[model samples]
Target chain A: MNFPSKLIEDAVTEISRLPGIGKKTALRLALHLLKQNGAVTEALALALTRMREEINYCKTCHNISDHEECSICQSHRRDRSLVCVVEDIRDVLAIENTNQYQGLYHVLGGVISPIQGIGPEELKIESLLSRITEGEIREVILALSATMEGDTTSFYLSKRLKDSKVKVSTIARGIPVGGELEFTDEVTLGRSILTRINYSQD
Target chain B: MNFPSKLIEDAVTEISRLPGIGKKTALRLALHLLKQNGAVTEALALALTRMREEINYCKTCHNISDHEECSICQSHRRDRSLVCVVEDIRDVLAIENTNQYQGLYHVLGGVISPIQGIGPEELKIESLLSRITEGEIREVILALSATMEGDTTSFYLSKRLKDSKVKVSTIARGIPVGGELEFTDEVTLGRSILTRINYSQD
Candidate 1:
């Protein structure tokens, strides 16, 4: 991994710090950047510079944004009466891509992981509580993952929001749509069976 | 792919210009960079900035170096009397990694591909010619690929060095060691057969 010079070595080292990028791949990327036109390379560099310089966390949702408030929070077309609480901006984007979720989103930044020394205090739980107390929120959907941390967070939030008049619900979990009965695992099959709906006429 | 801001979009677009980086991968890389510490991100940005601002072509060897001479050319321990001409710095690294070749290298930057509009003038052909005439040169090895373009370049270089006192040679080609003959194709088998060595007592 001995580079041609200190500058080239530094660049390669920095590139190798990126996720999944080894020294060889970093060197390849660095060499490609070196060979290209000055403006093109500078633009890529400026992106990294500006991302560090200009980007900030959205004060309302804790999502990465250019402004104090995120675009979803500022949008007029989004429903203000309903708020969907998610783990991250990735979840917000995923919900947005469905086009069915018209309500505004609240990014929790991360789930409650006790092992990582992160509790409710580290999350945006306080902000979420304050937002719900604004009196117009009719429902608060917990759109967290089905992992242990996600479950713990959902349980804590549900208990916290129990006193409020706003209805609390979670996204459904069971056998996936179009899944074959033979291929269904025992855990999923058990859950599906337990949550089975009664379709008999009264 | 319409992002919230044009700056972010432009950044992703520029990053996608790198080899093997598609729009999604570019966005991932950009986001990862954004998530990094300000100083770490800025260091990469600064490196990319200076790669264009400071670095230039080495007049003698055509390799990317900080000064007029590349590291290989400047090194006194290298076999200066023998020159290994290759397509790019990657080839130089390949030879260096072997720790077998101690000769100086001449990076052509690219091969003479007429279809790609890369002619002899586009490469460092003149620099190579000048190096050969510098005296004390004993051998000129064409450490190029077996591709059509690589062969064409090797042929051109061999012809140009015909009048010189230096001995010209190409790297040996045959089935790799520990390779199975049943798996080997007819062309490689034929070459191995043609260049078959005698197993008689020394």
Candidate 2:
């Protein structure tokens, strides 16, 4: 669409660069910003610029952080011996929100996807191995996705730590908690049966 | 959602302030920006800031412009005798894109909507009248939406210009060019039949 102003055109071009936003949506967003108070645009611009320029990754876990180490890594209450391995910081946020686990996280950044030209070396696997070598983390839980890339990454990490003394485990694979038996996929249903736990364990 | 960093939280909050975007989508966009090269965020911020700070409305027609006057109003080739009045700059762009009209445009900023607390005085009606009174524009075309508010604004403008020497007209209300008659609504189909033109006139 033709914009009446060059400034609007430029703004739309920049906004459409984002994922899921197209030129029309970008134009609508630009016009919306124009309709709102100037402070709205100012605050958005300032916040985004600050985030891009000043945000840091945790040196220990590779999670997004404002400082050298993330809050989770700095907290003394978390179980230092347990580390949950995941794909990125979003996964870290998801697991953290659940409040089921109280351990540090090791964000591998991404998985091994040959189609995308990504391999083990492209991720933060070295840092994760170094953390395990430090001898503080006793168990590493693989909390990655259930996709093929996730399986490949898990296999590679397990093979690399075969000689290490750290115990490597993976999150349980089964039907979702509220899922009905009839609607559940066969593979997950089979896994749920195979990994059935003692009813009185809780 | 819980953000790993305060910077990310701030960015997501600002992004979600815009129309349509929610907290989850905002978080996704913030993460996507972080994953991309820094230049993407930098350019977006700069463009939006510049647009918000420096963009102007055409002094005469009230259309969004980078300068005092818009290109449509500045062009000498456009018909000075005919003026198309619209609700906003987007309408001006839409009509211009058709490439069928050679007349200039007068953006009313918005239609008169009592529910939204918008009135004739709040729009550029006075400026449009002033332009018409200058004796150059012989015809005024109301190209506003076909909504109730649009009709109200058109009636208001036509009433105000009843005594003026310039002729007042509105866009034809009929079914769209490629629309199927069987699927067309009753009111639109009725209007189309009533306003049917001579085939040889084209």
On DockQ, the leading prediction is 2
Which portions of model 1 show Cα errors greater than 4 Å?
Answer: A114-118, A146-152, A173-202, B177-202
In terms of lDDT, model 1 sits at 0.82
Q: Global lDDT of each model?
A: 0.82, 0.92
Among all windows of ten consecutive residues in candidate 1 chain A, which has the lowest summed lDDT?
A1-10
Evaluate every candidate with DockQ and list the scores: 0.55, 0.74
The residue-by-residue lDDT of candidate 1 on A1-202, one tens digit each, is 5556667777788888888788888889988877777888887888767766777777877777777887878999988988999987667767878889999778887889989888998889988989889887889999999899999999999999999889999887788889898999897798889878789947
Chain A TM-score values for every predicted structure, listed in order:
0.85, 0.93
Worst 10 residues of 2 chain B by lDDT: B88-97
Candidate 2 lDDT by residue in tens digits, A1-202: 7677889999999999999999888988998998889999999999999999999999999999988999899999999999999998889988988989999999998999999999889999999899988999899999999899999999999999888898999999998989899999998899899999888996
List, residue by residue over B70-149, the lDDT tens digit for candidate 2. Answer: 88899999999999999987788789889999999998988999999998899998999899889999999999998999
Candidate 2 stretches with Cα past 4 Å from truth are A172-202, B177-202
Error of 2 at A88 (Å): 1.8
Against the hidden reference, what TM-scores do the models get? 0.86, 0.88
| RMSD per model, one decimal | 3.2, 2.9
